[model samples]
Target chain A: MTYCLGIQTHQGLVMASDSRTNAGMDQVNVCRKMHLYIHEGERVFIILASGGLSITQSVTTLLRRDFDQGRGLASAPTFYDAARVVGEQIRRVGEMDREALKRDKISFNINVLLGGQIAGEKPHLYLIYPQGNPIQATEDSPYLQIGESKYGRPILDRGVRYRLTTLEEAVKFALISLDSTMRSNVTVGPPIDVVVYQNNDLRVRRYRRFTSKDPDLQRIQFQWEHSLRKAVLELPDVDFDEGAEQVI
Target chain B: MTYCLGIQTHQGLVMASDSRTNAGMDQVNVCRKMHLYIHEGERVFIILASGGLSITQSVTTLLRRDFDQGRGLASAPTFYDAARVVGEQIRRVGEMDREALKRDKISFNINVLLGGQIAGEKPHLYLIYPQGNPIQATEDSPYLQIGESKYGRPILDRGVRYRLTTLEEAVKFALISLDSTMRSNVTVGPPIDVVVYQNNDLRVRRYRRFTSKDPDLQRIQFQWEHSLRKAVLELPDVDFDEGAEQVI
Candidate 1:
């Protein structure tokens, strides 16, 4: 299991993912889920993946080969085209692995988030489904999540706004969202990878990996807990008014 | 879809449920998911259910009939026995309808939370699965949730401590949890039903139904949202330290 999310704010994009993967409880392992394809100032595509490691790795490897050869995402004219390139690669991997997985009764499950900027286009985010189709995040709904998404979603629903949220604030939202998920779910664990892209920077500049004991991460966890508890206490008390219908 | 949870605190038990039911997007309605069986001052069983509406309703109806006849929950010896009574009804309902539902390619999905106290027993909460097995909540994990549960779980994880939380705080936590789910998930909505049972009271004395526009419910929602935003703002800013490993 994994938890990966991408946030597209007015100033830029934030992509984050947990590194833990488990085929089963006994086979837990840590593997990087965030992949970056950067052409310096020309273009950049950050891909975060969740699902069967083999399928996602195969898809990424294929995309990398083409990207290294100056094809695929390396040459795509826009973020949408780059999403299509990733989708096509996913389809290619499906053609190679889906039948065998089906024979074993393993569902063909993969969800990918493609978020980046082409030289001439706006930074964007897309969630590519197992079927190789893509859905882009919009200003009204500026975030996309995959794997163990619900635990962290309420905070995002309350805190993030595409136009008003800054890149820095988006990073905070992403980390807090990831923190909420990690606290509630065991399958998603550290080290966490976070990348922040300033809109139009075209090059990846800010990235951080927070291991399990990272002091900053611990502080965030501790402080968020404190704040939430305090906030919960300050909220209006439950009005167990006598007028509501009584079941018994 | 539904969201019902039972929280056992030091002072008592709090059971809450949302009232939304849907066969699909086009067929959505409000239906009560919380049922009560009270032999006042003796034994009180608050059952919150989620799953196939027909199946749960049937099980509850059967339980109600027997409770009225002084044969089922009314005759059970302890809270565990009461849980078993509920589970037996679930299995009976499965026997009656599972095959027909399976023939139509529908899954026999039902999850129930049986919570309350009998005169001789301590307050207890049990989660009865679709297979009619029951798992009781313990001091270490004082809450059980059914249906669309994840979105509302983090707050419960953070706030509810069986030996420490008061009944009032538990009610606040439960309401906040439900509000979080309602905000993040369309399938779980109001009017919400909440029943608070004081440990020795046996009978449920505090019950409230918060319809969509209920002023108190709206205030809780509004204040909680405000508090959360303020809490997020007060959280320590993310430290995108330059020393952390950079992927690009």
Candidate 2:
């Protein structure tokens, strides 16, 4: 299992992915799930993937092989076209491996969060499904998440707004969301890969890898625990029935 | 879909369940998910269920049928015995319906949280699985949740301590957990049934149903949104390379 999130905010796009992969509780390992495609001055694309590592790695290998053939992401005409190329690559991999995977009782599962900026287009984000189809984030739904998404979705629902205007703040918010899930679930862990893209920028401006010992994240976790206790205590007590005292 | 949580604290136990039921989005309706069985001074048992409504309702009916036949919860030798009774009831229902459900390509999915006090034993909580087997909550693991549980599990993981000594605080914390999930997922909604049982008291003292229009809940929701925004803004900004500014 993995947890990966991508947000397209007014300021730009932010992407974060956890590094843990597990077949079962005893069979867990670290594998970086974020793939970076950059053409320094012309374009930059970050794909955060989750699900069957075999399928995603095969898709990545296929994409890299195409790039080696000189039909890379940098040469694509638009972000949409690049996304289409990525989808085609996924399809190719599926065609080659899906049957064997099914025979082994394994799923042809891989979901990707693709976010990037090209020279002439605005920064955009998309959630690519296992079927190779994709959904772009809209103003009403500015975020996309895959794999162990439920634990972190509530924060995005209540806390994320279209008005958030800074990429730095968006990054912090994304970390907090991930922090909540990390605390609860053992399946998701650090080191986490984070990339921040600003509007109209054709490259990733800020990228960081977060480990469990990161001081900033420690502080955030501490503060969240404290604030939650304080918040719960502040709520008014429910009125009790007349004989309620008898139970205590 | 539904969301229900049970927390065992120093003061007693807190149990809450949502009222939503749906075959699909268009077929959604409200159905009470919390069942209370009290024999006044002898025993007090609360069962919060989620999953197939028909299955859960059938289990409830079976329990009541047993009670009517004089094998009631109050007559159970222990709280553990009561849980076994509940599990047996679920098994009976599953036996009756599993084949039909399978024929229609439907799952026999059902999960329940059972918690309360019996006359002679300490308060206890158990999470009953679809297979009818159950696991009791321990001091190290003081809570159990079912149905749409992932979204709300983080708070209990991060903030719930055995030192939490009051039902008021416990219920408030549980509500906050539910609020987070309800905001993120449309499948879970109000009115929510909340029940609190005090330690050594063989009766439920406080039970309330909350709706979206509840003023106190609205205030807490507003405050949570406010605090999360403030928390995000307080994080330090990520420093980036000079050339990176052009891309973001």
DockQ of candidate 1 (2 decimals):
0.61
Q: How well is candidate 2 docked (DockQ)?
A: 0.49
Per residue, candidate 1 scores C-alpha lDDT tens digits across A74-183 of 88887888988988998989999999999999988899999988887888899999999999999999999999899999999998999888887787788888988998
Candidate number with greatest DockQ: 1
Error of 1 at B226 (Å): 1.4
**Ten-residue region with minimum lDDT total, candidate 2 chain B:** B239-248
Off by over 4 Å in 2: A241-248, B238-248
In model 2, pairs of residues that clash are A198-B248, A201-B247, A202-B247
Docking class of 1: medium
lDDT of 2 by residue, A125-212 (tens): 9888888887899889989999988888877886677666467777877887888777778899998778888877676657777779
Tell me the lDDT of candidate 2. Answer: 0.82
